[model samples]
Target: MADPLALTPKSSYAELPLRIVSAILIAPPAVAAIWLGTPYIEMVVLAAVFMMAVEWARLVGHDRNPWLIGAMTAGAPQPVIGYFFGGFDIAAILTAILFLAMLVMAKIAKLPRGLWLAAGIPVIVLPAISLLFIRNDPMGVQTALWLVAVIAATDIGAYFSGRTIGGPKLAPRISPKKTWAGLIGGMLSAALVGTATILLIGEGDIPLIAVVSAIMAVVAQMGDLSESAVKRHFGVKDSGAIIPGHGGLFDRLDGFITSLPTIALATALSGASVLQWH
Candidate 1:
């Protein structure tokens, strides 16, 4: 697909300024919520998840009425709420039931894009729930901060390195601009930020943090590429115009959506403090 920004010529680089401004506006409040914990974080997560659902629906060609979009978005948070009240078991059951109901509803209503709609449940809810789980842990604050830092470092490093190097494409078919250099740069940056953050503020084996950070960096990039594939499949440039330059909440949070759940699962299985080595 052709680059959307390229079509505008004069405004091709306009996205950079808008992206910077949006990040400045969003980061502070997000950090505050992570620090504040619970209700605040939960609310913020729900809101983001809802927006992502809407954007997902829009990307899949379901843009008739705003109410229908809103209804589709509503399902993303149900499982998260279930997890909060009942635990993972209940959350799992709820997710299954919800998925089946959505499939049936789509079939009955004859929604053309039912599969993607059904997919929104797990795609959006799992990460949101993972974030909640991480933030509710004893070392919640540190873990949340670590996750944010790693993601930010990965994105920033990849952006600059890819632009500067501009060599081989990481995945030419999916995201032409991404490069192997960018991937390595992102992983290194994540390792550095994650290792330093845990060492200074919390406790952990530095090597373990570095390794996990590197892995999460790769996962985050994969998340980005996956989103890009979705856009390419639908032949749309941006998911939505919700964020000035960032495209949409999904565009902005795709990395977090994938990485958080992976990290959360790692933490769960290892029984380690997210900031500390087992």
Candidate 2:
């Protein structure tokens, strides 16, 4: 029987060039920033998060007034910046107050879809905070690289595996293209990448690294699915036309946004050197 989920050979052939080109253009700078760490990665995360806020606003109909959307986007990174100066406890409190105030204001203004308008806070702030925290750790650069490797492997594996061995859809209603085979492939690839990264960086528990990597891969897929759900709810095809084949920064970084916070949390709780895992 024909595989209903499979993309036509011709269609796959047509998209391959564009996908490859887009990946080539995007991967180098991102990897460079991860390697450099600190201020550079911080800046990159801030800009990307702000762009994601803009895209979210646009999707949820909050961008009709350019100035309002612009202000909101510009302000999205304030909490993370606060973290830099005021520390996490104070920054967390301030962020909560700020988000509450924004929500109250949205209600007062009778904004359309006030809930989603409020959602723009965590959508940008949490991940920005997470990335900043992770990159500020003692073994920050290595930790960041491990994250990048896992995410990259998951995305690459899913893309190729899904395209080549398409079968049952993972979530037909949310993202029709994702498949069970692709999910398994992504998890396996993430595990492999994590193991390799740990070994390359020095000694570590390979089993623990693989387990963590697999969990992250699953979370990344969940993040992607959540974003897809949002887009579908808004009745839009893409978040924005910024990236050539990727749609928008949000579209590209959705998995990262979700994964970073979890990684950061685990790193903190475990109190292990993320690089050494010791």
Candidate 3:
């Protein structure tokens, strides 16, 4: 591991404040949507689905094909949106069809990154579905808030600590800016968030909540690293320039991309709200 005190690059510091400001702007709207539930949250998911799908498609396939590549990814969101009114069977069918169709289209087009292009479907769709899943829970709004807090805390903690601690890189090949200290800091931060959440609820096992949040921090980092790896593979810097400071929807929401699906699955399997860590 690189020494924790070692100073790193200066570029991050230059953009740090802008990043924070941008996040502040985006958070309230998202939180409101999550709190409102039904059509409101559905609209947020749809917007995210559109942006993230376009960004992913643009990244992997648009190098040469541009609009056509983006068009191919359009089918993914339909199934997720269908789940809101049409139920799971409709969603499953659309997802399978789109998933296979992307690959087939890529193969026909002889795209070098056919796999990557097809991956955009799951990458974009699953989380939208998961967001809906969480939102539909009786305790949905609170659960979503807790999940978002955990992810945001992880990202914020990691961003600052990685710069401040300047330690050995975590997955340097995938994301050179990430550090072991940042990972630890993020886990610790999320653990704190979890503890605070339990306290605010006025009950629950603190240590368990802390541990789960820490694990989720790791998951969010994994999502961040995975997005970085994809960008690296494509030789692209930032997914898109949509957000002034945050790159694109994908760049900002990558943690949610992975964490949502995982948490949703956990909720399904455990028969419990994520907020109820106890």
Models, CA RMSD each:
3.5, 3.4, 3.1
User: For model 3, what is the C-alpha lDDT against the true structure?
Assistant: 0.78
Per-residue CA lDDT of model 1 for 1-278, tens digit only, reads 11211111122244456667667867888899999987899888888778777887888888775755876777777887888799888888988888888789889888887887788788888888888888877887888888888988888777666656656778888877677877888889999997798669757778878988899899988788888888888898888776654577777777887898887897798776567774
Kindly report which residue stretches of model 1 are placed more than 4 angstroms away from their true locations once superposed: 1-15, 65-67
Candidate 3, 130-161: lDDT as tens digits: 88888888777777898899988887777677
The ten-residue window of minimal lDDT in model 2 covers: 1-10
Instruction: Tell me the TM-score of model 1.
Output: 0.91
Work out the TM-score per prediction. Answer: 0.91, 0.91, 0.92
How many angstroms is residue 71 displaced in model 3 relative to the true structure, after the best TM-score fit? 2.7
Model 2 lDDT on a 0 to 1 scale: 0.75
| Prediction 3 TM-score vs. true | 0.92
Tens digits of per-residue lDDT, candidate 2, 1-278, equal: 00112332222745556556656766777778778876777777777777777888887877687755875776677887888888788668767876786688778888777778777887778887887788778887788778888987888777777777877788889888778877888889899998898888777888888888888999988888888888889897778766564577677677887898898888889885555664
lDDT over C-alpha atoms for residue 44 of model 2: 78
Residue-level lDDT for 185 in candidate 2: 80
